[model samples]
Target: MPKLLLAGAGHAHMAVMAAIPELVAKGHQVTAIGPGERHYYSGMGPGMLGGTYQPEEISFPVRDMVESRGGVFIQDKVARIDPARHVVILDSGHEEPYDVLSCNLGSFVPQGVVACDNQDGANGPGAAVASRSVFPAKPIEQLWKARQRVHELTRDHSIRVGVCGGGPAALEIAGNAWSAGRENGGNGCVVQLFTGGKLLRNMPERVCRLAGKVLRKRGIEVVEGSYVRSVQSGEIHLENGKRYVQDVIFLALGVRPSPVFRASGLEVSEDGGLLVDQCLQSLSHPDIFGGGDCITFVPRPLDKVGVYAVRQNPVLLHNLQAHLEGRSLKAFDPGGAYLLIFNIGGGQGILYKSGVAFGGRAPFWIKDFIDRKFIKKFLPNAPSETH
Candidate 1:
């Protein structure tokens, strides 16, 4: 039997894990490695922050699912991938050799861009730069904890919350905070959304306009044409020389691939994502494959959304199986358009797909139902009826 090692229980790996029995029946030994006991669904993350769902509601236990499939479950983060040796080195210093490797390792917030330097003698994650008020939006666990801390500390203060970046993440954070703050009796918290260009610049103009309206109605101050230069001493400094004192800062800047990949020596995209072909296999290493946010499909410049990883599942599994069996692999082609859902907080959502856009409370219900069904399937009590 061919030994296959799957790294990071992200969207793509979860799909493969769900289909593991078929691969096992075909005579392949599979093992999965990742950091958490539960796999958080990125699709519902914004809703999770908005109090629409608890962490348990948005996540499913990966270790349980994998072990049930008779696959090895290593609850550890991969420290490095030594493709040359066909082994994955875990943070615990143990190595797992494999005949084929699938990498679904996701990206984290770029510390260099988010954290503030210890400019004012304050030591923290982003201490090298002049921004003492910088915050990173990733490693969701840390971000969530930090957000809780902010809420606790600013409970009594006249909070001035400033969110940076114009992406979907930034909007989600700003929206969720604004909606939650109102419920907590923290009215007029001075929520501000600052983006260098148009908010949601990459998205359709209509969506951006709708988002701007929602933010404005929720009392969020929107600042455009402003580029952040540096952070200093509880203040946000803009490239245009405007500065503002913010009680809390949230960095919603774009994402980049994990820096550890550089040490792995795998071919990477300009933006630091693993460069992969149509089959999701590493261009430089045949045995290594990647999906999720850490990889970019070379044939298309699609948004690095979780849906891509979802769609890559069958293709990844098929290609990995074929490669192990010495058979030709099939290529994957994503449809021209995909479903886009945005959480606007308070059990509300906006969904867009193929030039059609709709927003209302009903979409939120649909989102919740879909998310919960996914969670149920992987839960320990899911029905045993074979697919």
Candidate 2:
């Protein structure tokens, strides 16, 4: 039996966790490592920010889920990977050897935008300033905690909230933050969304118009056609020489791939994501596999979205088992046009796919049903599946 080591409890890895029993029965030893015990479902992120769901409601306890299936779970981050020796080095200096390894480590916000000094003159005077007030909307937990900070700060005075990025996450954050403020006695709070390009660029123009309408209705100032050049204390400077006053900033900027693979000499995309073949196996090292946002499928590059990751779960599992049993591996096909539902807060959502867009209460219910169904599959007794 080969030792299978799963790195990171990301969306695809959640499938592996749920199938641990079957994998164990097939004579494979499974070990999983991640930085935290819980994995937050990104789909419900907007809901959480809007006070529609609690932290526990959207998070899955990865440790308990894996351990219940007779697999070992390590709550630590991967510091490095020694591909030559097939060993994973932990931040604490421990090493674990494996016969096969799969990584689904999620990406992070670009460090350049978030790395600021904690003290005076940390990044030098007049340089881009980053303080505790800046928050990145990735890794999920940090964003959840940032919401608490926003609530606390808004308890006394109205603050200007800035959100960067043009993707669905950014739109959702802006709406949710505005809703959060209004519901929490900060009705006069101001919200600004800065996007380098048009908002919801990936979606159809109709969807974009709907999103714009919703944001306008919520009084979110959408600054388009320019990106943020730098952020300083109490203000954000745009590339177009425009300045916006902000007390707190939330970055919904897209993620960059983890550097662990690139540092290990693995074949990686220009963005530093692991390059994988059709079988989801590493192009440079076949013994290694990767999925989710950490990998770029060479033949058909996919957008860094959770829907693709969720779809890859079954393919990854099939290939892993095939490799162990010397059977033919299956290729993953990311078909064009998957359903994208954006939760716009207040029991409303927008649905877009294949250039058709619609918004109504029905889309919100659909999104809620789909999200709850996904959570229930991996989580036991998941709050009776309510919309």
Candidate 3:
């Protein structure tokens, strides 16, 4: 039996772990490595922010799941990968050998956007001064800390929050902030959402408009058609040189592929994503496989959303098993028209898919049900609650 090294306990990897029993039965030893006890479902993240679901409801025990499969779960980050030597170096200075490697290591939020100049002039004299206010919304713990910091900062005083992104997460954060503020003390806090392009650019215009409307109706200010050039202590500089004051700024501009893999000497795309072929195998190495946000299939443009990773699980599993057995590989194609539901806080959601849009509490309920179902299926049961 060949030993498989699975790096990153991300959504894709978690899905693969849920089916690890079959893989183990097929004569393969799977070793999972990631630095987390729980895997939080991104779909329920918005609901979590909206206070619709508790944090525990969104996260499942990955440590427990891998143990159930009788597989080794090393809760450590892969510091480096040596493709030629077929070795993965861990952060703790341990090394592991792999017969085959599958990378679902997820991705990192772009440092360029987060560390970009904050022209607010509050931090320093320079006009292009970078703000220390960046909050990278990956690795789960960082985002959790950010939320905690925001809550602590806003507890005693009226706060003005600015979210820097037009994506679903930004909208969800803005909505969550507004709803939380309203519940605590309406008008005392202000939630502002700023976007570089129209919100949800890939989605239909009508859908974006409806989303904008729903946000506006909730008293959340939506700023569109502009990029935040820089941010200062209490001000945000727009690309047009206009400045808006903000007490708190969220650097949720966008997410990019993980830089760790690129640092490993793999062939990455121009956009910094792992270059993978149709079968989701790395172009540079035949023994390695990759999927999730870090990979890009140029022939078919797909969203870096979690759904695509989830959909790719079966194919990844099949192709992985076949590759190990020296059988023919199968091709996996991502379909068009991704179904998206954006949580607008206050127990409401805006559904958008294939140019149609729907917004209501019913969608939120459906989303909640779906999210719970997913968590129930993939979450590995833990021995005890440590968190």
Candidate 4:
């Protein structure tokens, strides 16, 4: 009998969990390790913060899903990989050996970039900066706490909310923070977005303009071309020597792959992600595999987004099984242009795909419907049948 160990409960591992019944039936043991009991969907994180959806509505309980399907679930984080010994070291100091290993460890927001100091404030396993009460916008679950903090601050008096970063996640979080501060007996709440460069710097110009227009309409000031140098004591410092103090700040400074690969001395890419071929197998260790934000594709670097993780699901599902059965592996094709939608809160979203972009109530509705449907598949009561 073979043992398969899943490193993290991320988007790429959903299909693998769904196929657990089949794997278990084949005289194999499957175990999944995750830091939390539930895996929050990144797509709906902003909406969750804005109270558009409850926590239960947007997250999949990792334990229930895996256990219900005859798979073992470990509620702990992976600290390091001892690939030479074919063992995984847990944060709790336990070791688990496996015949095959898959890492979907995911990414974290790099706080060092936001703080621009040695503070290393980026979010990993939901930790905050020691010097300041700054929140890094990764690990997804922290957004819920951020919402609570905003609510508490808004109740007594007007609060200033600052969001750093120019990416979509930064925009969504800023808008959601604005929404959270304005509700539940809230007073005046001011929101400001400080981007290092043009907002939506990579997207089409029209998309950037429309998003900025909507944000300003909602009373959220868009501060373009302002690069954050350091953050301390709830004050934002710009590289050009401008400083703005805020009551609350959300760091969306962008994400970097988990440091475990580099720390473990694996053959990592320039970005410190595990280097993998098109087959999604590690270049150095054939027994090791990965998907999602943790692995850098050798053919081309992939953007860290939920869409790629979703696309890699079926490939990992097929390849993992094939590897165990001594069958030929399948290469993962990243496919064509994918859909992108930003939930800017207040029943509004900006959607873009294949060069067609739209904004308004329709886009928000479409985004909500899509997110809900995707989450329904992994619910505890969902059918046990594999696709």
Which residue window of length 10 is worst by lDDT in model 2? 378-387
User: Which residue pairs show collisions in model 2?
Assistant: none
Show the lowest summed lDDT stretch of 10 residues, model 1: 125-134
Predicted candidate 1 versus true structure: per-residue lDDT over 84-187, tens digit per residue:
88899999999999999988888876544334445365555455434423455665653455446455645676577788788988887787766655556544
lDDT accuracy of residue 149 in candidate 2: 69
Error of 1 at 145 (Å): 2.1
- For residues 178-293, what per-residue lDDT tens digits would candidate 2 score against the true structure? 77776657634688999988888877889989998988887888888888877766567788898887877888878888889988889999999999999899999988998888
Candidate 3 structure quality by residue, lDDT tens digits, 111-146: 443334434533333233244444545554544554
Candidate whose lDDT is highest: 4
lDDT of 4 by residue, 1-387 (tens): 899999999899999998898999988799999999999999999999888999888899999899998999999999999999999999999999999999999999877644422355443323346533467788788888888888888889999989998889999998888888888889857988999898888989878988988887888887876699877666888888898998888889888899999999999988899999999999999999999999999998788999899889888988888898898999999998888899998888999999899899898999999899989976777765443
Scored by Cα lDDT, where does model 2 land? 0.83
TM-score winner: 4
Ranking by lDDT: 4, 2, 1, 3
Candidate 1 global TM-score:
0.90
Q: Rank order by TM-score, top first?
A: 4, 2, 1, 3
Listed per model in order, the count of residue pairs whose N, CA or C atoms clash below 3 Å is 6, 0, 1, 1
